[model samples]
Target: MATYEEVKDIPNHPEKYLVDVRNASELKETGVLPSSINIPLPDLERALNMPDDLFTKAYGRDKPAIDAVLIFSCKAGGRAARAANLASTLGFVNAKAYKGSWTEWEEKQSQNI
Candidate 1:
């Protein structure tokens, strides 16, 4: 699993992609993580498989390379885990799920704990 600190350091690591598997509506309800790009779980596979230009246009970021670091996060942790697994199966050598996800992130950010 990806740690909260690792996810938080995304800005310093352009090579890593912080992917939020939550749907658009969820992101609207709960603020998205900084530097994260939403690819809703359902569209993840297609997005990953699509051409680089298409992926870039759709996500405003280049699609991650086969061996790039893919950190997945969701409302809690379930979907994130699934996302990481899917990415790994599709040849992403460094895919990982943030077990704490948004819940832990929100808690930590809110209380500054």
Candidate 2:
């Protein structure tokens, strides 16, 4: 899995995908990445099983392509790692977890809020 710092250096590419696995409340408590797919982990199962048309309806038609780099993040590393593993098993080629997550992000930035 790539560290947030490492990914930060990657040039902005529309092909890269950032998936935030945090729930709505957690996202509210800790801000999300500027451009990220906000798909809570608990809802992963249904989304995975969604029919092609339904998938577009639920996850949006712009859901990142499977070939794109899938970076998953949560409050801590635990959930993000699990989500990454699941994505890998499901055929996401470049699935990765942001091990530091939001806690580390806030700490590294020294953001009080």
Candidate 3:
């Protein structure tokens, strides 16, 4: 799993995949990381298998390479961890959860301001 400090650098690294596994309503209420992809936890597996063109059209980003550095985040950490586990089990070699997830992200952002 990634620490808060590590996750903070993800937005600047376009080559990495940052997935927000939170639902639509949570995303609407809390916003999201600037370059993160929003794939609800329930849809993650299907989305990952989508054709490149279809995935890009739906998510506004290309599907990540199997070996890509994939970081998953949610409101807390449970869901993100689960999603990361699922991705790993499905053969994504570098999938991991953001240990602090959204709660830590929000806290850090507030501190920054």
lDDT per model vs. reference: 0.95, 0.76, 0.91
Candidate 2 lDDT over residue span 1-113, tens digit each: 86867555444755776778889998888787756777899886566556778767876645556777888888888988998888878777888999997778778767545
Worst 10 residues of 3 by lDDT: 3-12
lDDT for model 1, please: 0.95
Clash count for each candidate, listed in order shown:
0, 0, 0
What candidate 3 gets wrong by more than 4 Å, as runs, is none
Best by lDDT: 1
lDDT (Cα, tens digit) per residue for candidate 1, span 1-113? 99999998998999999999999999999999999999999999999999999999999989899989999999999999999999999999999999999999999898876
User: Candidate 1 regions off by >4 Å?
Assistant: none
Error of 3 at 66 (Å): 0.5
Model 3 residue pairs with clashes: none
CA RMSD per model (angstroms): 1.0, 2.8, 1.0
Clashing pairs in 1: none
Instruction: Report the poorest 10 consecutive residues by lDDT, candidate 1.
Output: 104-113
Candidate 3, 1-113: lDDT as tens digits: 98887788887889998899999999999989767889999999999889999999999988888999999999999999999999998899999999788899999999999
- lDDT score at residue 1, model 2, on the 0-100 scale: 83
